[model samples]
Target: MSDLDLGVIGNCAVAALVDRDARVVWYCLPRFDGDPVFHALLGAPKDAPDDGVFAIELEDHVHSEQHYIENTAVLVTELHGRQGSLRITDFAPRFVWRDRLFYPQALVRRLTPISGSPRIKIRLRPRFEYGSVAPARTYGSHHIRYVGPQTTMRLTTDATIDFIRDETFFNLSAPLDLFLGPDETLQLGVKETADRLEERTLVYWRTWTHRLATPFEWQDAVIRAAITLKLCTYEPTGAIVAALTTSIPESPGTQRNWDYRFCWLRDAYFVVRALNRLAAVRKMENYFRWLMNIVASLHENDIQPVYGIGLENKLIEREIPDLPGYRGMGPVRVGNQAYEHLQYDNYGNVILGVAQMFLDRRLLSPPNRADFQHLEALGRRALKFYDQPDAGMWEYRTRASVHTTSSLMCWAAADRLARIALHIGETQRASEWRASADRIREVILERSWSKKRQAFVDSFEGEYLDAGVLLMTEVDFIDPRDPRMVSTVKQLEKVLGRGPHMMRYEAADDFGAPGTAFNTCSFWRIDALARMGRVEEAREYFSELLKLRNRLGMMSEDVDTKSGEMWGNYPQTYSLVGIVNCAVRLSRPWEAII
Candidate 1:
């Protein structure tokens, strides 16, 4: 393997392998939610001719393989060729420094040749505002100033980086350095005589991993997944993006492209549950604090399904006319329009997650009583519009149906509100919320279940089997062993399970076409199996899903089982969380069926 044929996708961000060389051929810097600064995964250089911003051409390349560190966020790509074998480690340091948050701003690509000397290429392209604004570069011996609107990136290199027109590219045989200034001045340095960057990277990763308090047997994998999850989390706002890049079609050349880098309230409960399972209290605390801020800032009726990093509620969707999409998929987009769509299920998800946080005895400090009260007020207001049709979890194109998932979430909200009232000693409020929750549950059970199908339907009157119903087990709305649950799982397996991977639903009905199998849904099935006392089946399915992880132990949003190509966004947080959660569940002895 002389060529670096690697790719990474997560939180809607997609990156491609340039070659065996350590250089990142494709990457959108600053944030995954941001537009592309480097986009080569979509197609050849011709499609995005004018939009071509940053391109690195490496020298003395060899063999390379990408892998995540044992239990941390660091990504390592080992390269070996005619000159020597060098290890390049990439990571965004986590520990807070001087009251300034140090996240994934600086792309730390560490290179150490094991044997003979090998030259490498380095390129720097700082295109602000999604390659729309080209910055003027002023070069110094060790510094390069990239001036853009409201942001400046001071690129500092240990080895001289040759400045190209609107880009920077360099070839080096020794240590190299670079810096990326997003909002503030950033410094990067490499020295002949200095502490090992690898050692420091290991120290940073191991120290962080040790903070996890869970003693689960699958701690290694779980810790790695947790670290990935943390890396995906936007530290400033406590929002975890769905994936790093967008526009990677679920089916090649299909119209299933979606931007997932925004914060989704529907992911709230799952994120909290996974973090709590790992005993990661600090993360949950930060997330809840962010949630509180969102609730406090918005009026009850103005709540959106998602928000931008700065807590901006409006995400007007638009296409970047310049750049072509990944693998020729057209219409590359940013700023999710779905935020404007009514996603009623988010209310339930938020309430459920907050309630879970309250239930956890590990809450470092008691939540503010006022915050809880405000949350309750929001829930009550949302209930007024709960009967209205809105986009469901899939965020479909046509008018929203009576989505079973959304309705279930409504029940979840009411149930959690009742729990919240009980927690804070509000007996009267507790009784009222409890009654409301019971009513909602009754309505769901009566209206959502299809007698003809013998299982819960996707909506009030539809007979389709949606994989989302598996969440019923996760939410505790239905016992895993309930006959309905069994029937639902069986129906999904027959209808949607393609080998080990599962589809969201029968796709022929809406969205024009179905997509490649969704990796998250497959893990959900594994979880459903485990919860239903099918431990053996769960383990089998879980093992198969684990095999789908790329050579780097990372998973994408979907997989083409036929070609074994990982499609959609790379390094999807939901799939990783599902894997970790399911693994944890399966690691335990088979408890009595739920």
Candidate 2:
């Protein structure tokens, strides 16, 4: 009976999700794709003592409220009991230290009594290797160390150790501080350190949000979405995760969940594009370095659709059978299978992700001819695979067909390469790439378009309607105002649109037809609607779609149109980025506001 009523706190190195009652339910140790140290979000077995959680439970708890501390990743939760009330402040410290970015792999919590005498229990359960190992514990006067085979975690706190260890409620007279992170002694007292880190982290986040060039309208919502998007970034490697937790189902009573901790090449681009719209250049630059490392490491033209944050290419798909999933949906997967699939659109996405680096004068390191040469290799692969496909962007498990989205991305790769070549004064190379782009575009227009149905279908020589065809205008493959493009949008609306939602597609895939509407696709629908001169309707749907975000202005991968419950991975980057993009497209100009 668990829900997605969670708020996230992070420092780009590690993140944790805090449930409504201020329990740290989901936390990964050391890094984003690392072991789940606090795994209660994906619960343990039925009647298994509810392991993998760090909870501060108020005795006789009646109701609670949770929210972020304005324009920051810091979260505050209030618990009200019959006797008294207390406030819980949670955040992972992030700030500049020693003239460098200091984001440790840690989470900090502060408990302050608000009213009359309040008693609370501390439940700190740290699991290892996906809930297979329960670590042995050792304690000092002020800290407890959890030692396991894979990792050792420490909790340094000012609270009573016996009360925490024995799960007994204790009277709260003064504020308490708990710092859970690597097994290390605090340089200072827990209270002073937590307070200092909280203040620094607050300043850091406010400064970060202050710099964002958000649209005047929906300023608060846009800022929250942008901050969440920033939290999903693994700063050391510049890899942005699709979501924080794994195995959150796409809908109720379904096994449609997959681990989303890894960085997908396609998804990373969209995230970068969204941040770039707000003039946030650090993520783009760091991600460009990450992207170049991946490109440089490829001995051949081969690239994966997803990889570990550190750029490790081998992401073998597997399931941890022992760990029960979100709300007891089992089969908690670790690695992703999409890494093995040939998602052709990734080629274009890669080039598009870094294409601006060549032209943006603000970049510290600009692309040189050598980089273009390597990209030419990718363009050749694009040309070779534009008309062929192994998996579409949706990652169909059992089928492989020539998808229109694949061809469009390949065309995008060539098209961007041509522009890059022109910018670098390589007319000959530009002409060649332009020709490649033109040839690919012709085939896409010829094979993907359906004459009888008057719309572009999902695959070549196929009559199935899909929301993916709406990307034709997104990548500039077709004008949004074109008659053919207009008809395709109309057809998709009839076939896939549900109220303000839009399904990924109507046709059955390896997992039968999708039930929850893909939230990202619905944003894509808004863009199409606006571009096709349906501005008022587009604005209305955009406003409606904003309601699907959780109380913290966070979104997921999919949403049930009828019930309005968000599903899929929590705080999905695809859905979050859609908010920024749609806002930019639909917002009134700054000139008008000024």
Give me the candidate number with maximum lDDT.
2
Give the winner by TM-score.
2
Per-residue accuracy of model 2 over 550-572 as CA lDDT, tens digit each: 88888989999899988899889
Measured against the true structure, the TM-scores of the candidates, in listed sequence, are 0.89, 0.98
In angstroms, what RMSD does candidate 1 have relative to the true structure?
Answer: 4.1
What's the CA error at residue 23 for candidate 1, in Å? 3.2
lDDT of each residue in 1-594, candidate 1, tens digit only? 111134342221222233334445455555666545555554323433434333333345545676777765556667766766566655544444467543445544555555666555555554556556767777776667778775566655565545433344333355553433344443334442123444554676677678876434556667767776766677666776776666667777776777777777776557767877777766777778778888888674656788875677888887766556775676777778788887788888777767766666767765867877877876786566556677788887567788888888888888888888898798999999999888888888888889898889788878888899898988889889989889989989998888888988875645564768888899899999988989898888888888776555567788876665788765677887886788778885334322
What candidate 1 gets wrong by more than 4 Å, as runs, is: 1-21, 25-30, 42-60, 98-101, 132-134, 162-173, 182-201, 213-217, 507-510, 589-594
> Residue 195 deviation, candidate 1, in Å?
4.6
Q: Report how far residue 404 has shifted in candidate 2, in Å.
A: 0.1
**Each candidate's clash count:** 20, 0
lDDT, candidates in the order shown: 0.68, 0.89
